[model samples]
Each structure stands twice: as structure tokens, then as C-alpha cells.
Target: MNKKFYFKSYKTKVTINGETITVSRKGFFNLVLLRLRTQVINLNNIQNVKLKEATNFKRGYLKFVVTKGLKHRNVTVIFNVFENEIAVEMKNYIQTINNK
Candidate 1:
């Protein structure tokens, strides 16, 4: 089964299936900024995953670090504290995948 997360405020959606993770963006502004693109990263190419837990004062983000010199750019999703649970889950899942 694919695990999915949607962050409405950021206009982004994330999906994890098998050994790959996909990040997609939506909304008119995001499209105008050329951020409305889909990025897929193979678990094996991910070097690290970071999750900055959100607090009352600030929002948090989830980031994926890919191997150096690769065509794939790093992926980041900004989210509010309410969305932190899924972000943490994604971070853990990716880390476990990289360790195997």
C-alpha cells in the first residue's frame, strides 16, 4: 500500500510506495513559480531525511537529502504543526529504507 500525505497550505502532496517517494505540488501560484512539479526519488539514492518539528511559534519542514552529484534535487515540504505527525512518520520510513 502507498502511504500518502497532503499539506493544503503548502499545496503539496507526498506519497511513499515500495522503494520510492514522490512529491507533487499544486495551485496557481506554485505553477507560476514553476514549483508545481512532481519529483520522485528512489529510496536507495536518499542519503538522509530531516524533519523539523513544528512549534507554536513556527512551522516545520521535511527534507530529503539525495546523494551528491545526482540529477535529482533535494525535496522539501513546509508544513504546520498539525501536519508534523505524518512528516515524522515519513522521515522514519525513509531512514529505515536507507539503512537497509
Candidate 2:
């Protein structure tokens, strides 16, 4: 099954399937200025995952530490209070995959 979550405030979307996780940014500004292209990460390539719970004053973020070369690059998706649960779920799902 394919599960998708969208965070409107951050203009980011995360899609989880059995084998891969896909992340894409929405809006023209994010596409052009940020140069944030869609990232398709395989389950095997994820080194670690982190989820920061959202507070009233600050937005939380789900970060994926992807294995690239000698250094790791973080792919983060920001989420507000309303999206906290979904972000946690995504983190849990990735952890489960890594354990297997």
C-alpha cells in the first residue's frame, strides 16, 4: 500500500510505499529558489531518521539521514502541531523497515 502525507505550510509531501519513500516540494518558489527536486530514497539507503515533536511556538521536523558519499545529507520535512502524528508515523515506518 502507498501512504501519502502533505504538509501545506511547508509545501512538502512525503509518500511511503513498500520499497521506497518519495519526498517532493510544492510551489514555484521552492522549486526554483530552493532547487529542491523530488527525492526518491530507497529503504536500504536510509542511515537514520529523526522526528522532532512540534510545540506551540516552534514547528517540528522529520529528518532523514541519507547515506551519500562520506558525508550524510539530511532531507527534512517540516510539520506543524497538526501534522505531528503523521510525522511520527512516518518515522516509525522507516525504523521498522531498517530493522528488517
What would the TM-scores of all predictions be? 0.81, 0.84
Q: Could you tell me the lDDT of residue 33 within candidate 1?
A: 74
Q: Write the per-residue lDDT of candidate 1 for residues 1-100, one digit (tens) a residue.
A: 5888898877888998888888999888567875558888887788778789998889899888887465656678888888888788878877776676
Q: CA shift at 84, candidate 1, in angstroms?
A: 1.1
lDDT of 2 by residue, 33-79 (tens): 87886989887778889889998999999888888678778888878
- Error at 55, model 1, angstroms: 2.0
Q: Please report, as a residue range, the 10-residue window in candidate 2 with the lowest summed lDDT.
A: 28-37
**Cα lDDT of all candidates, in order?**
0.81, 0.85
lDDT of 2: 0.85
Clashing pairs in 2: none
